[model samples]
Target chain A: MKIAKDIKELKDAISKFSGSVGFVPTMGALHQGHLSLIQKARAENDNVVVSIFVNPTQFLPGEDLDKYPRREEADKKICEVAGVDILFMPEISSMYHSDEVKLKAPSYLGYILEGNRRPGHFDGVVQIVMKLLNLVQPDRAYFGKKDAQQLVILQKMAKDLFLPYEIVPVETVREDDGLALSSRNVYLSAEERERALSISRALKAASRLIMAGEFSSEVIEAKMSEIMKDIDVEYIAIVDRDFRPLKKVKIQNSIILVAAKVGKTRLIDNLWV
Target chain B: MKIAKDIKELKDAISKFSGSVGFVPTMGALHQGHLSLIQKARAENDNVVVSIFVNPTQFLPGEDLDKYPRREEADKKICEVAGVDILFMPEISSMYHSDEVKLKAPSYLGYILEGNRRPGHFDGVVQIVMKLLNLVQPDRAYFGKKDAQQLVILQKMAKDLFLPYEIVPVETVREDDGLALSSRNVYLSAEERERALSISRALKAASRLIMAGEFSSEVIEAKMSEIMKDIDVEYIAIVDRDFRPLKKVKIQNSIILVAAKVGKTRLIDNLWV
Candidate 1:
């Protein structure tokens, strides 16, 4: 696989490819979730491009940006083994500049759930995603459903900005224990890892409630909250596909979300019914 | 020229053209300045696409949004004569949606001079321009230099976003009497028209001062102020190309800008030395 370490090299490599390009953007330390996205891209397009840049703007002041995982050697090996045509690894300086244009997420939708906990996080996310989309010019971009809100916000941004690419939403890759995979999962201690299972358990409980024709969000939220009561639960929300609050869940259109802190690490999971 | 009144039509027409596309996005009030931009686009690329959408996001609540000029028939004729291949005229609903992501201008460069006079104006400009640029996906995009700061800001945004198109900065078109051409010039009455001449005249005087080796902005601004004393001058600013204030003119890198109100109409002009 060809590697581009700078913008010029990436642009040159991208220019040489005329076929449909499938892109998967990640922040290094490739996990099974990222591998699933890359594998989907590899299967769908003539050229598959994967980018690994731990964007600093997406992290708030007190966020875990400095301690974010970075395993470049392992990530490169995984991309090559996955048959990625090009791997773009740009420096932060090439990606951002001081006193430049900034993006703002939607006020109402962007300020709920994860956004409420991390204000201005979606703005940074939309900004970096936009820059990467423009640079990649992919025919299709793959994103896992693990970051449900992020996926929805990115899909909205692509439509609102008139970007000409399809956003392929892949299902969240989970462990054998039903724990949703995440890069931050590495931050969990042994006991915390065991506790993190509560998140998925809560989501599964909600899914079961929905499957049994119990669409009342209040009852489902109560049960989910009870399941996650052992941890430091932040919120349990039932919303539509657009992130609008729904008092009662609409099957196939509803999303049941949960965010909580397992020990010191924060974790989130959702079930799209 | 083919007219596309919706996004689907525009995309269909754009997809059929396989050559280099040069785009000119306007607000449907074609003047000499816009014609000049179209002419340059025609000269450079095999295909020329012109969009005439009076973007509502770019206009403030009290701005001239409702009263903005709309001469679609005339604009169509002008584009046909100018050899434009595609004319995209999408509805506001087609271009934007409720509670979606938005773009923000830089706090430092985008909030001075014009941005100061009209807050959040550049934010709107950047947002709409980004949408239009992404939709057009042209090989080159053209903008008149009369809106110097707007051009600079757009260039910065395109670069910052890594958009794959060249921003061709066309010189501002002027009349024989030295007034910069603008669609909004029609808002001026006979007397207001005559008074508005002070803007260009003051710029000319500043140019002469620079020619005569007057480098200090304080000395030059004082003289220009004297020339525009009769008008309701809002501001007389001398700054670098990046919109930062300069103590003295840097010859090739300086810009002298003026904004004034004449009988309820606001006008702006600038000279790039």
Candidate 2:
């Protein structure tokens, strides 16, 4: 696998490829969730490009920008093992400049659920994603469903901005205990890891309720809240595929999303019913 | 030439082309300025696409958006004569949606000169241009140097965002009497048009001063102001190619820009020294 450390190097490397390119952009802790995205990209395209960028803009002032994981050696090995054609690890200085154009997330879609809890987060996501998409010019870009709101926002951005590439939604990867895999998972303590399992359990409980004919959002949310009561639950929302609030779950169109504080690390998980 | 009035049609039409595409995006008044851009596109690439969109976002509340020229028949003939392969004219509803992601211009570059006079104008310009560029996916995109600040801001956006297409800056076209060609030029009455010539005259006077070894921006601006004494000048400032204020002219790097109101019509012209 070829590793490009700069924009020019990556551009030059990508320009030589003649066939369809698939891209997987990540913040680079490289959990199984990210691997699923890369594996999908590898299976679908002639060239697979992976970007490992801990974009500073996406992190709010008090957020985990400084302490974000940077396991470059391990990430490179992972990319090599996954058959990535080009592993782009651009310096922050090369990717961003002082006083440049910025992308703003939609007011409604960008400020609900995850967007509400973390304001301006999606803006940074769209900003970096746009830059990456333009640079890669991939035929298809893979994003995991674990970040459900992010996936929806990105899909909206692609359509609204007329971006040509396809945004493939990969299923979320999970632990044997049902906790969703996340880079932030490394920050969890043993007790916190155990607590995080309730997030998935709450989602599963919601799923069971749905399977048992609990179509009303209010009842399912109340039930989810009870399941996550042992943990510090932030929100339990039932929304449609477009992220609009759902009064009643619509089976294939509904998503039951949960966010909570497992100790100090906030974790989120969802079930697409 | 094939005409596409919607996004899907244009996408299908463009997907069949196997060669380089050059694009010119306009608001459809069919002036010589626009024709020059199309002609350049036609010469440089295997296929040429032109889009006529009177972007409402770019217009300030009191500005001439509704009354902006829309001579589709004449514009179509011009594009056909210029060898344009495809002409895309998307309706406002088709191009825009409620609660969509938006692009914000840089605080500094987007708030000076015309941007200052017309707040949020560059934001809208970048927003629509981004959409159009994404839709066209051209090898090269053309813009006239007549709108110097817009061109600079767009160039910065392309570089900052890592856009794949080249932004070609075509020379500003002008009439024999020196009025810069613009779709807004049609709004000027015959007498107002004669007075509008001072905009170019002021620029020419600044050029003559530069040729005579005058390097001080203050002194040249003073001379430019004196030449446009009869017109209601909005601003007569000299700045660098990047649109930053310049103390003295830097020869190849300096730009002298002017904006003035002739009757109720506003006109802008510039000279790249």
Candidate 3:
């Protein structure tokens, strides 16, 4: 209900809370996925803080940073309706300085899937998350499983850096058509929206293949590739919970991740099997 | 003092404390400088935690990491005497992972002066410090100003990353003869020890110049250099609090830093003017 536009106000607002704090950090234009994270946080903690920062550092030079969706009034209404104790919307200038310490994602794991497509993207993610975590100092921080690679990297960072908070991953939220909800979904044209469904369809097909005892990564990936033959598939990887490549899927520990361009808007989705 | 050798143990030990914690992170040589930091921490907070980690990442390949002083017993006694509540000494394996998130010090500020002499050194410093700070989660973390550049870099990191704790800058402790107390001073032979005193002596000469109304940085650095002519002076820099090069000494806001080698040992010292 309380909106904090700066660091000092946020700190002051957070300091008044005596119980455990749960945080959900997101870029603006609250989607169903973000709402799920906030709802989870709301249910889990005495104080729920939501930060909507479209961090510039996370976007590469050619990335759609400028065009990123901003629905501040709507986001505020969503947070209020969701019972968020505090909503933090900090200016970019306040969050970052010209020359400051930066974080580098793990050399091997960071540069693989999403990182390969968008170099230095995870670095920016790690940097902003670190700042947000430090500022919020939440008991538990909610991150959706939709950004599987990001979730894994953040978990690794939290452990490696000795961050004293739990990274609670909420299940990915999907539409009735099995399409994962993303803010970037707004960028899709009417026809492109229909094509984007193929991504989830491919993932569903991979799931069915795995359910039918096709554990071989190559076979599943081949089938997944076939499912989205018309779409621009960037990669379809089978990796363990830790993001290490697996030749064969290990049920309950494996994730089939897919990334593709649907009409110039890159989308990523994964299924935990 | 309770000695915690693992993360879980340290966390449990820290969890029992309900008061403010002040921390001093060191590499366990128990020198006067370190003692001063621990003493300051003890004085400032309800609980004091000291960590003795000879972080290998901070040391370059050819640098003296293995031979770095590790007087565990003596350091323990010093911490106990200094009223430290907990002393955490974690194994290298426990503190770091093979492939994990790493910190990069600001490109420009990190790669200059001492950073220039030892590339990637500040990165390691920031990385380990970040880990230790997160693990301890102290109210205040203490650092001696003897390593002026390091102090500045860490302060920048704390502000930039929005670390919740305060970085307390403690005054540098020195021997009666004016040698800045350092673990590396152990490597100095009797003859080499005498030569190392010139580092502090040069700083003193510069101070005397400043006191005598000689504000020109170039003139003061030239004098300081002349005083340490016998030693291999790595650099003689006069910079502002933020590490920006100063044309003339800005009273109450400038630092004169010195680094030199005596025999095979590298030593650094600085003066806050």
Candidate 4:
């Protein structure tokens, strides 16, 4: 696979291929989750492109911008082995400049869940998404449902901006245990790693309740909360497809979401019912 | 020419024609300035498309959004006469929805000059430009040099976004008496109309002074200011192509801009030196 570090060079390289391009953008700590995205892109399009940019803007001040994991050599091998046609590894400078345009996520949709904890986070997200979408011009772009809020926001952005590409939402890839896969999972200590499982366990519990016809959101949230009681819970919301809160669950359209802090590392997980 | 009022219809209409498209977006007050842009688009591509939607977001709260002129019949005739193959007149509902992902202009460049006078203006400009460009999928898009600041900001947005279309800047259209052509010029009264000539006169005087070897920006601005004494001048700036201030004019790379309030109407004009 060809590697590109500059915007003009990457654009020029892609320009030569006048075909359907599939793109996967990542934060470069390669694992099964990222590999799965690239694998899907490689399988679906004539040209598959991946970008590994640990974007600083999306990380709020004091939010682990420096500590965010970076495994460049491993990431390169992962993409190469996955049969990605091109790997774009742009420096922060290549993606951003002083006095550049900015983007803001909607207040109603953005200021809930993840955004509630980190204000202005999705603004950075929309800005980078706009930039990356512009840069890639792909036939389809792949994003993991692991970041469910981000995926929803990106789908909204594509619809609002009239972008001519599909946002393919791939399901989250997890380990043998129910723990959700994440690059930041590396930040957890052994004990914290043990505690992180609570995030996924709570979602599994909620799913079982839903399957057994326990439809009251309040009852389900109470049960999930008891399981994650040790962690500092941020928000526990049960919402419909549009993210409007539902006091009671609606089968086939409900999502149970939870975010909790496990010894300085924040963990979030959700289950669509 | 075919008329389309939404995204699906426009795309379907254009898909029938297997040729390069040139797009021109306007606000439906088809003046000679807008005509020039459409004409250029018509000449450069196999098919030409025009969109006339007075975007509400770009206007400041107290700006003339409600009163902005709309001459649809005249505008349609002008587009037809110019050989435009498609005219898109999308409703606001079709173009935008609630909980939108918003775009912001580059802080430094977008916040000065026009941006200074009309805050949050370029954000709306970039927002619409992105949508229109995506929907039209044109080979080239045309913009008038009359809105010089707006044009520059749109170009920056395109580059930042990695939009596939080219932006073509057409020269400003002018009246016989040297007033820059604008649909808003219709707002001027007889007395205001006469005073608007000073805008172009000031630009010409600055150009002449620069040609006579008075490259100092102070000298040129001071002299131009003298000619526009009766008017309430907003800014007389000598700047480079990027809109950054230059102390001395650099012949081919400089622009002299003037914005003044003539009677109850505001007018702006510039000369590319």
Candidate 5:
């Protein structure tokens, strides 16, 4: 696999491929979720490009930016094994400059769940993704559904901006214990790790409720809240595919989302019904 | 010139061209200035595309959005004469949606001078330009320096976002009377029209001052302000190419800008030294 550490190198690397290019953008510290995206990109396109940029703008002042995981050597090995044609690892300086254009997250859908907890987070996410998308000019970009809000917002932006690339969403990858894989998962202590399972369990409970003809949002949220009683539950929401609030669930269009703090490590999980 | 009234049509029209495209985005009411951009595009590229979008987002409330000039037939004739291959005139609904992602101007440079007078104006300008740029996918885009601040801000955005297009700056076109050609110039009464000449005259005076080796920005602005005394001078600024405030003229890198109101019509003019 070729490694491109700057924009100019990445552009030259991307220029060599005339066939369809599939891109997967990550923040390094590759997990099962990121690997799955890379594998899918490799299978789908003639050229696969992966970018590992832990965008600083996406993190709020108090967020875990400094402590974010960075296992670069391992990430490189995984990409090489996964048959990534090119891996773009750009420095922050090359990606951003002071007093340049920025993006604003959609006021309603963008600021409801994950955005509510961290205002302006998605704006940074959209901005960095735009920069990367333009630089890569991929035929299709892969994104894991683990960050559901991020995926939805990016899809909206790509469509709204009339970008040439397609946004292909892959399902979230999880551990055998039903814990959604996240880089933040490393921050959890031994006991805290066990406690994180409740998040997925709560989502599973919500899924079961939907299967049992429980369409009321309040009832499903109540059951999920009960499953996550021990953990610090931030919010349990039922929203449509567009992230608009749904008083009652709409099968095949609804998503049950949950956010909670397990020993100071915040995690999010969702189940599409 | 072929006219495309929606995005789908525009895309279809654009697909027929395989050679280098030079794009000129305008708000209709075509004047000599816009024609100059189109003529330049025609000369420079195999395909020339011009978009006539009023772009409502760029106009803040209480601004001249509703009353903005529109001369479709005249614009079409001018484009045809200028050898434009296509003219995209999408409806507002086709270009924007509610709860969509938007762009923000640089916090400092974006909010000074013209931005200070109409806050959030550049955000809309950047947003629409990004959309048009992506949709057209031109090899080079033409922009007149008459809107000097807008040109500078867009240059910053294109570079920061890594957009795959070259920004070709066109010289500002003026009338025989030295008045900058603008659609808004129509709003001026016959008497007001003559009074508006002060804007360009002041810019000319500033240029002459620079030629005579007067480097102090204060002295230059003071002389220009004296020339524009009859009108309500909004701002007279001397800044470098990047819009940074310059204490003294930097000769080759300086821009002297003036904005003022004549009989309720606002006009802007600038001189690049």
Candidate 6:
């Protein structure tokens, strides 16, 4: 496993590798969910490259940027075990310059849901993703469905910019108790961890209601919001595949999402029906 | 020369050509300036691609978009004589989609001079240029230094986006009367044509002043503005190569630019020292 700390080193490593390349970009603190993505890339492509960058621009002030989880040695071990060929770890200085032109996330789509909660978040995501995508030039990239909107926007970027690659979306990994896998999960204390499961529980309730012919978006959201009564819910939304809000859930085209603050830690969960 | 009307066709031509590609994007109505670019591209690159797109996004409402000069037959003849390998004539609809992500010119640099007078102009220019660049996939693209800010900003975009192509800047082609070549010059009547020479003459005067050890930017700008007294001068300013206003000319780093409305036609001209 080669470790590349800069773009030149990464490019040299990529040149050494022959055949198809698969890439996975992460914010470090790898868990089973990230490992799953790496493993899939390793299996599908002749070479797998994983980038661990804790992007500062994505986090607004007062957001958990400074304290965001970082397990460098463990992450390296995980990548090595998952058969990653190249591990790109860039410093903040190497990846960005002063007053550079940046990618702005499309205003209409990006200003809703997670984007609203973390304003300017996706713009930073798109900016870094664009840089990473161009540098890696992978045949396919792996993104976990845990960040559904991010995955969708990255897909849109690829298509919009005519980037030559494919986005392979792995299903969201979950804990036995139904809590979605997230690096932020480390922020939860025992009691907070228990309370955090309410997010998944609410999403499960929505899924069940949908399975039982409850297609009305308002009723499902109302029921989900009721179940999320223990926490400070930011939003309960039912959006179409394009993210436009719909009055009724159209099967195979709808996603029910919820965002809530569980003891000061924001948790988001959703199910596609 | 082969004619391409869509991305697929353009990329097809691009794929077959392995050597360096030189590109010139225009809005038809082939003039001496465009011919100069085509001739230079032909002389330098293994293949030459020219795009004639009367980009709608770049034109404001009531800005003569409908009556923009487009002499297709003459354009083809000019390119053929200039040895262009491929001529790409794309429809505006073919290049852009509804509700798409867009490029914004730098807020600080874009909203001055030409941008202030014609807001959103550079955004549209950057937007179309990006699409054309992507479609062309040229090893090197050419832009005349006449559109100095546009050229500089495009270079910034290429660097910011990690676009792996060189921006080859050619000199601005001018007439015997010192008027910079422009398609919009067609909109100038005979009297306005005589007045339009004021832009180039002011730029030349600024060049002469700076060369005579006049270091103060304010002094140089005042001299240039005085020369364009008859024209409705929008702005006469001195900026560094990065488009930031400079207090004093830093020899080789200073740029004196002038924009004026001569009759109904707006003209921009600049000199980089």
In the range B92-121, model 3's lDDT, one tens digit per residue, is: 999889798999999988999999999999
Model 5: CA > 4 A from native: none
Docking verdict class for candidate 6: acceptable
How high a TM-score does candidate 6 get? 0.92
Off by over 4 Å in 4: none
lDDT of 6 by residue, B1-273 (tens): 999988788888778887788998888999998888888888888999999999999998889899888799999998988889899997777787656666778786677777887898888887788778767767788888889988888888777777767888889999999999988898889999988888888888877877788888888788777777888988887889888889998888877888888888878888888
Error of 3 at B26 (Å): 0.5
Q: Estimate TM-scores for all models.
A: 0.97, 0.98, 0.98, 0.96, 0.97, 0.92
Report residue A110 deviation for candidate 5 (angstroms).
2.0
Looking at model 4, give its docking quality level. Answer: medium
Please state the error at residue A70 of candidate 6 in Å: 1.4
Q: Give the CA lDDT, 0 to 100, for residue B230 in model 4.
A: 84
Docking class of 2: high
The candidate, 3 or 4, that scores higher on DockQ is 3
Candidate 4 has an fnat equal to 0.86
> Residue B152 CA error for candidate 1 (Å)?
0.8
True contacts kept of each: 0.92, 0.95, 0.99, 0.86, 0.92, 0.34
- Residue by residue across A1-273, what tens digits does model 1's lDDT show? 899999889989988997799999999999999999999998899999999999898899989999999899999999999999999999999899878798888887777889998998989998998899889999999998879999999999988888888999999999999899999999999899998898999899888888898889899999988888889998888999999889899978888888899988889888988
Query: Candidate 3, residues A86-137: lDDT per residue as tens digits?
Result: 9999999999998889999999878998998889999999999999999999
Per-prediction RMSD in angstroms? Answer: 1.5, 1.1, 1.3, 1.6, 1.6, 2.5
By lDDT, the better pick of 3 and 6 is: 3
Residue-level error in angstroms, candidate 4, position B48: 1.0
Tens digits of per-residue lDDT, candidate 2, A66-87, equal 9988899999999999999999
Q: Write the per-residue lDDT of candidate 6 for residues A30-138, one digit (tens) a residue.
A: 9999989998998899999999999998898898899898899999999988889999999998888666666777786777899988899988998888788778889
lDDT of 5 at A202: 85
- TM-score of chain B only, all predictions? 0.98, 0.98, 0.98, 0.98, 0.98, 0.95
